[model samples]
Target chain A: MIDSIQIRDFRGIRWGEVDGFKQLNLLVGPNNSGKSTLLEAIYLGCTAGQPAHWEGDSFEPAQVSLSGRDFLGDLPLLRVLKRHRYHLRKAGQGPYRDGCLNISISSPAAPLRRFQLHVPDLPILPDSLRDMDSKISRIEIDEGAQVALFACASGRDAGRAERALAGRILQLLSPTQGAGSTRQKTVQSGHKTPSGPNKQRRTAQRGARPSSGTAGPGQQTAIPRRPPAAQHCIYLWYPDLTYHSAGVAAWSLTGKLASPEHVLFFDVSNTHYHFYKTFLRDTMTRVPGWTYKIADCLREVLGIARSFDFHVQFLPAKDNDSLIQGWIAPRDQPALPIDAYGDGTRTALKILASLLSLVEQATADSPAVLLWEEPELFQNPRMLNRLLREIARLIEGKPLQLFMTTHSLEVVACVAMLVREGLLPADSLRAFRFSLEEGTLRSSWFHADNLLSWLERGMDPRIWDTLGVPLQFTLKEQEEGAE
Target chain B: MSAAMGGSIDAFYEGMTEKKILHMLMQRGLLAKVNLCDGKETGKTEVNRRLRDVVGPNVGTKQVRCLVLRDLDERETMERIKQGLQTALQALYRERGHPKAVVRFVRHRAHGNVYLHTCTELDVRVALHIATYRHLPDFCKSTIDDYVLRVALHHETAAALIKRQGWSISSKRIIHKVTSEIPALLKQNGIPMMGEAKDFIHFYAALLRVHTSPAVFAEKILHHAPESELREVFAPLRAAAEFLQDASSPSMPGDRLPA
Candidate 1:
């Protein structure tokens, strides 16, 4: 649903923009082409405010003490802003300049919103302490959330000021509270402060929780519970409403939005056999029907008549810790432990399980984006072909957007052949070849016509050899003595 | 040739055979300026696509000319292959919706030169010379084998071997068998092909080397050739420099030959 994305001074990319994205986009290139970096950038941009959930790390509310780095964990909203400075100058863009890491998203439903975080020069401090700084920064979200800044003094006075500032920022981000309603109560850097009921509410909220284990003796004890007014604040940071709202709107325009799962990424390089089995087991637990679908897909694609069976047994010796065991049952054969299968079979099972899980979660109205990095790992050509075909079916009638990066020519050829054969819609598929040209990252879109022509001529579609000239030879005259 | 003067010739070939031939011709001072294409052949469709891209739309105005050289592959006759190439070119121009042009094929019997001219409506010339080699000529082929034998054995021993063996077996088979038989062929004897012989054998051996065997005589043996032995090996190729020199002359535009 993202029409285009422009990235500048982010990770390895100096400046690059990819426009005219299709439903299913394939980023094909050699290693170090910034494919993974691009995905990371997208993920970061979408989940900007909620950095704790950014890497799928579990959120612990108990980590909200008013001392040390642990307090920073409570306010995940500010973590990404602090990390923005680290992204600066890393792309070889000279000395760090005072520029916001700009992520702009546009949609037909809403006006363009440019989420700008003015990366400050100071090292990242806990939110309780950071409120003392006087530098006023404004982040504008067009027709959406508008963030206003206020300053506070350090020490005991600043702790109360920090809570007030947090409450105010939360007010700004929360959709239920209008920016117009909170205009008169705006606290200035050194002068004005919130008094009366708002201050008392924040003070009460700060006094409810016990001090964290890491909190110092001087630090305030028992941070209070969040007030009901700030309950709607965290919901504003939901990926569905913030980063991927444009995609949601795009989907709505076409009429479908049943599920809220936006993005799923599979990094095959780090996914070991055990790690994959665990992920499959977790998905199967979440969506029980997905297990059967995965089994059917494995049998149809890999020609392996095996069904997954998972059992959780409690161990009394280890204080009743539950251990999950996985078994693969073959038709008319004894059920064997899933670890007995080859890595390829396990990888195939994981991929199919992930796809089935996405399908189970996706609805006609709400579609998800699947980012698969190197699915070709440990998969042979036949398995890859079947996987692609299954993917083609998975996207049918569903609002799923699939993005994959691969170095396999077989995968490229299979996709091209599928499009050529009308198994996948030509318009839905897009291929981009990323290359480093003249010390700058660049991408070229391969036209479907050219790809189909290459396939028709029995040439490797992945190799863009047309950019170079062909070698030639002079004809040899007939030998005099020989026939 | 100075680097400044090295940009004039635009010759495209099917594979390594033409590249070696052109390289040798350049070394021998037969062709002053030549630019050989550096890619492997995919198929006729890709080749035609490349032809249009490299040649550009204004074919008559540009000084750039292309010469396509391919072997007379066993599956097709020389005339049929030539016709197929011409048809492919015409189809490419038509597919691009370019103005129809008169395609004329010319072969000079005296010089053994073949030229295909694609002329505009106004008779402006845009030419592509096509040539096919069934096998390397006897002189070049024999010279390459003799050089290989000399490098693999002592002169008297090589002469005795040639005198005793004669030309009953194929030169490629003879070279393969003799090189394998002599354990010290690569170590004791230096590569015999250098200078002219290196150029000639590279082309000659590559042509015969296609499909029949994976081993290339020039790459395996010539890579081991000592610098001192190069002059003697290249003498014969230098002597046949006139062949390339004769082909470099611009052929008459209107000359038409029977297919």
Candidate 2:
């Protein structure tokens, strides 16, 4: 688990720092309090090494380039060689000097890596000045050490360095997090490159003598490779009026729709009413004419009640395009010819399908984390409450870790109701208050009760009138006295 | 003179007869003295005895020591009876929390002189008198200027005040002379006559009352000014009154002006 993160001179933060997290962490603060910024920072740092298929496509080595001048500014030899002027002035030991980024990380379950990237400031040169031979700079993890990878026009040391660097980075990526405690071996065993093309000439150039221990044969070396674990992120927001009263269902099912590897996807436009129907159907036996079982596993997971095995047909995306194309479930569902249903059926089907999918996942050992934003859209208050309760019921039976974000009092109230009914762990439930302080994003975490109180005092008072809910407390003392 | 019985109107007129009874009662050295008539008609003797019993020491009375009845003509008596009852009740109040009561009454003419001829002790009389005066403070800070200003502002009628103060000069002449010298009065006090004339009169009258009797003060200063001039001179006072009215009146901001 990543413990703490400190950032400086990055976007939206000067001296930003935040810490304290558990298995299921939450970020909440006022708008522009940098909650999202913090999440992005973690995403960037972990982007370093994710390539293997077992780890999934999420952790591929995306390209991010740094210019050659940064190295000239960071290294001591380049400083004197280039006679960079800006470095001298900003050499002071303050946080935001000319060039310094010392990042420290600690993870007991994973390897601890420190990345200190710096840039040196160069003197201003005339506009016309240009160097034809100057090369674009690159940084690479080489033989367990950070080495400057340069691409010269001449391509002199390119071939050897490329092979060595690629091998080293690959090794760095392949280490298992926890192997039987025999001290797994490092990927690089002091690999050195020949300075000159002639092997004897390179040996003569470096007169070194240090006896090094050799690795026993058939010993498993620990490569720095772990499946880029599903990056659990919950992006919650109070949707616009268009999405108000919209029931949201999203999960990544890792398999084909028909095969055992298949996972279901259901998107509902208005989830409020449908959630109740699905919830009742799941908990209670339906009457003979009202319900039928779909032997097709995918259809069942999708919560499509089928009258007969042959009658089971995949519905077209016409009715479910927006509903199915939600956050988590990748949009690959084959479209069938079906008219867009009215809002009531569309919304109900969307929520029912999502709940059905959740019921399927809950049957499994590991359930996908649900990310929902503003599920209280377009529905009456009663519908909103029912949707929340159904969501809670689905969550209660399922092993899935649920993460939802909302600004609606009814939505929060529903979750609180779940908390009140012992459907979810009170402590497990977290509400984050996101706000801006000192031009940086800051957030405070709260449990269900705290979230409820904050909603009542901070949000409900301001928006209650708009919601048509009777003002629980008067807005002004004078009004209260008059009442 | 015939031996007149006490409590009868006849005995009151026959002063020597009542005085003889009083002297005899004093000589006899009774705890309480009473002159009585036989209970043949209206019980004049019984009334006297009852009065003695009410006033007598060790007779259910906790504090009262003496009582004085200043009767007057019927109209005056009725007015004074209310005034006297109110005044006595006020005197009995324990404003300081300590359980002590002293009842006294003052006739209308006794300006600045409160009669505390009660059955209470001398020290009690002095303390109660001081406390009564202390309760009439115009401000937290005690000053002659403040006292004068307070008196001028609160006292309603100049003629009444003059008559009540028992001023020697005719109220009209005093008022006329003070009115004529209004400019000099303002100049003497180093106060500008920027406000209404009534304001000036009140302010000046208050100053005058501090050093002189209220009657002299009012007659000499207040009555000379006409109502219009008084209103003009008391411009600041008018402003203060306007402010008080605005603060008290109930009207919302959006109310339309009357056509």
Candidate 3:
């Protein structure tokens, strides 16, 4: 169990300390209480070894950078970028407060090892806002002799950049040697050598086509990235703008069949809802150890599963713009792709698949760490409950640890139930109530007993409304006057 | 008779040893409560036939005296005592003139039973005894019983203290001069005897008195003497008493009167 966490000058928090985390930790805090900031900090710390500044030049839509003005112009992208900026600043503070994330992890008999994940700020340029033509800057992991893994990216999509880096770090801790990767060869034969006539005719026709040295790499020819021996850490997000049809198609085709070692990342601004569904479906099917039971629970409760392969597309964005999309399954299934299922079912499926993939990837030899932002997005109480219940079950009897940021009480309640049922050891479950107290993010752990008691008495619903505010207020009013 | 009949020849020869001959004679003397004496001056040859049986070889006479006193002066003042042999010898002779003063043992039974002096002095100025009561009335059985009790308590207390402290003092070594030994060591020189409970009250009050009036008792006893002595010497007793009282008190305020 990690004994405690002390953060300094990271996001909304100037300095915050929390002690007593068992194997499982649930952080509860107000929206701005730096709950997500804390998770991002851990991700950064774990993957802080590599330099972010790398070589890549691809002008993609997701890479199109915008200024504070242009970024603000698009409310959805602006909000997304704002959160990224906060993380960047936090990860960059060096002397007085290096924008860095520090993590402390421990085993039963081992001492705590403090690690720092450092990343330099890589701002997207206005010209590259529409086409993501940026690259990673610098990543420094384990700066102080502490164990850390770092990755750097210069992509227009900071979310993908971070996820790619996180995946690299997780690969170091638990290397998955053999499940999803395989090698194969092809053999061709001809009767009587087909020799004279057919062989020469084919050669002569090929030679007549003109020698233009312009052949691109094909899907079948492209060499796959060998699975990293170590376990993986996944970073994911959804499309912020633009149509996601093409991205969604690519996701189900080759992406689904790739090694599970490839951490799932959703740059929503450049991804369609179908991509999420396909990813979920593929993760559920392809991963060696994910299950539909968790999915069923989610569906029964939430009435939705985002990636159940229901073939439904074109979810309305915050700006009221519809991202055109579609879902296609193999001919064997025949019916509309599973993505066609209702939005709720598809959403639930996506959440369950993501959780299960992480769980499956997390074997004893290579356990994984999963991070998710706003897990409660488009989720109702039942769905949220099912999702949390599934997550607890995933880590229930495994070596995997999960970190997530949520603004839903239902999610918190589910976690509390898991803790109460003894599914999670006292030290395993942790929650932080977060809020901006006096212009700064203040955080404290929510004791399970105290939280249940508070819930039993029926807390104000507003705590769920302003994710950061209500939690902060409740925690402050309750914890500040401690006897 | 068995030896005369020759059934056991060893029995006939047993009287040849000095110890056996002396034992046989002592058994015949019936020395149950009486002091025994040996005839050391008798002719060795004339008594040869039964010399070993009539008187053992070693013979000596030691004088012993039993003197009794009472605290009759009633002064509460310190009484000066001194040993004078002439006065003690005359008193003993007057009390038991018919007996020779061979082995003299001086046993005093005043405030309590105790062995008085090892030997009485020859000076006639000695009173040979002191008094709190008028006279040594008759040597009644009740007085003896009281003496035994006094001796037992003193011996027991000393033995207990030695056992408790794991000290080396033997109970036999502590000769009780009077029943007033413990109290006298705790209070001033001429202080009167106060009962156990009254003694504690007086001791506590003396502590209060020392702080209040330091000059009143300075002539005979220092103002701080009683309090200091009581506090230091009786500390264990005082602590035990306090503990007992506290344990007996009811904790609830309203339940003080058993309502």
Q: DockQ for each of the predicted structures, in order? A: 0.02, 0.01, 0.01
Please, what are the lDDT tens digits per residue for candidate 3 over residues A25-132?
A: 556555566676566444442322222221111211111111111101122222343336421112211231232333332211111122332223323322222223
Give candidate 2's error at residue A457 in angstroms: 6.0
TM-score of decoy 3? 0.33
**Candidate 2 chain B lowest-lDDT run of ten:** B126-135
- Residue-level lDDT of model 3, residues B201-244, one tens digit each, is 22422432322211121211211123333233223222222222
Give candidate 2 misplaced runs (Cα > 4 Å): A1-50, A53-313, A318-348, A362-365, A437-439, A452-483, B1-259
Q: How well does candidate 2 reproduce the true complex, by DockQ?
A: 0.01
My TM-score estimates for the predictions, one after another, are 0.41, 0.29, 0.33
* Residue-wise C-alpha lDDT for candidate 2, range A24-132, written one tens digit per residue: 2345433445554454333322221111100001211111111111100122112221221111111111232233222222212112122222322212221111121
User: Which stretches in model 1 have alpha-carbon errors above 4 Å?
Assistant: A46-260, A273-288, A305-340, A363-365, A437-439, A452-483, B1-259
Model 2 over residues B23-96: C-alpha lDDT tens digits?
23234331133222111112222323222222221112122222222222212333444354444334333321
Candidate 1 chain B weakest ten by summed lDDT: B1-10
Backbone-clash count (model 3): 119
Q: Which portions of model 3 show Cα errors greater than 4 Å?
A: A1-4, A49-286, A289-343, A422-427, A438-441, A459-483, B1-259
Identify the CAPRI category of the predicted complex in candidate 3.
incorrect
The prediction achieving the highest TM-score against the true structure is 1
Question: What is residue A321's positional error in candidate 3, in angstroms?
Answer: 22
* Weakest lDDT window of 10 consecutive positions for candidate 1 chain A: A53-62
